[model samples]
Target: MTQIVQSLAEISKPYDALFCDLWGCLHNGVAPFPEAVAALQAFRASGGKVVLLTNAPRPAKFVIESLERMGCPKDAYDLVVSSGDAAQDAMFAGAVGRKVWHLGPSKDDGFFTEIPAEWQGQADIERVDFDDAEGIVCTGPFDEINEVPEDYRAKFLLAKMRDLPMLCANPDVVVDMGDKRIYCAGALAVLYEDMGGEAMYFGKPHPPIYDMARRKLAAIGGVEDGRILAIGDGINTDVPGAAGEGIDCLFVTGGLAHDQFGADQKNPDPELVRAWLGARQTDPRYTIGTLR
Candidate 1:
């Protein structure tokens, strides 16, 4: 029985910090949600630390740059941790072989070039053609808005035949890019795994990113496990990740699962939310219509 609260202020007192998801919770890829921004700023003003955890498939700096472009101020959160940063460490450590094929858009080229200084000298990664590559590194579709997971079946089959392991940076299947939902690297990873090709992940609901978040959290101020609360709209990522870490979760019903609760953005029917969450085998500590 998840408590459907009206706002974050009601239950935020017990928590010292937040492990917050970004995509659907903070911004819609086009712009920052004003209410969501206020909620985060309020949380920080109350002396709570906010770590913006995301599966954006790119390093944290790129995420911050995009936020700046969207006019989302830097004071809204304490830090940003990304799946791409974790995956980059693994890649340099040989999670996938050195000779890998890059499968993503031109905008994501920074993933290979803008790595952290620590991994710079140790990394000898090379992006080669699919046929000559030792493994595959997938950030996302070459054209996210125009492509679907099924569009890459032929290439996935070839990778399966060659037994090339895929390193998936993002684990989100689909996200609302303003008005349209677009497939992400996780969708491709799921299809690849269904085709018997191995796909490794480092994002939410996965242990690696959580470990990274905790380590980063320690740097600012180590919030005890019992005093930390996770907040997000991603039931798949936020709920499961918080549960796995043994922390409370606040599910924003208006994000990815907004369709399940109907059109009233500010008033989500609790029963519908319960039924849907029960179906997913998740029991988040709290639920709200939106972040504010």
Candidate 2:
């Protein structure tokens, strides 16, 4: 059974490096969670190295700016690694081809600013010339707050018809927006695959970003994979990603999947948490109601 703890202080001794997630664990897309921020600060105060690993489809600079805007203190993390930064290699190199169709919000336009590729905006997903396009890069939904995954059904069908491959910048299926859950780019990528289109993910639970995170960890005095603790809110991405890297994971109960485990920000049902973990065959080393 996963050890349930009230504070990360109870189990922070063994780990020297932390691969902590950003969105749900530290903030809810709008504001920073004070307890989570304190946990990371405490971990750092104890000489632990922190690498803020995120599946956010923007570069590290963009994420840092967002975190600062949300009032997440700078000292809480040592370095930031994002899937968008990892995908930049392919984005600039034209891994699929030069002509690409962008399938995300305009705010994320910075992703393609440095690259010299033709960007067919999200004007008409259904009518975009898929045959002429090399691939599609999805950072997020065109309208995350007002739309759902089902809204992209006809678009995915059209992409499938042309046998276009998609480069999914963020691998998160959904993120909690305060009390509501919003679909992410990964959800759209899955829908495209379900419609027989190829998809390439570049984030957590995938090797590329983990490889990048490991390099960052190595630069600041290396820690054994076993001694590095991975903490996050998502069972789908974080747990499996840590397990895939041979690192122990601390599952945060009050994050995105809290409702599934009958949990809230302040209290969580341990029995329900265990059942949910058991059902997924996930063996997280630790569990906490919130990051603190």
Best by TM-score: 1
On the 0 to 100 scale, the lDDT of residue 184 in model 2 is 93
By TM-score, how accurate is candidate 1? 0.98
In model 2, the runs with Cα more than 4 Å from the true position are 114-131
The local lDDT score (0 to 100) that residue 149 gets in candidate 2 is: 74
Q: For candidate 1, lDDT tens digit of each residue in 1-292?
A: 9999998899999999988888788988999999889988999999999999999999999989989999999999999999998888888888889999999988777789887888867858999999999999999999999999999999999999999999999999999999999999999999999999999999998989989988999998898999989988887787898899898999998888888887797789878999998998888999999888
lDDT at 111 for candidate 2? 79
Question: Listing every candidate in turn, what is its Cα RMSD in Å to the true structure after a full C-alpha superposition?
Answer: 0.9, 4.3
Tens digit of per-residue lDDT, candidate 2, span 1-292:
8988888899999999899998788898889999989999999999999999999998888889999998899999999989887776566656655678888998787777633233344222221355567688889899998887789889888888877778899999999877788999999988888888899987999988989888877888888898899999989999999999898999998888776756365567888888989999998989988888
Mark the 10 consecutive residues where model 1 has the least summed lDDT.
114-123
lDDT of each: 0.91, 0.84
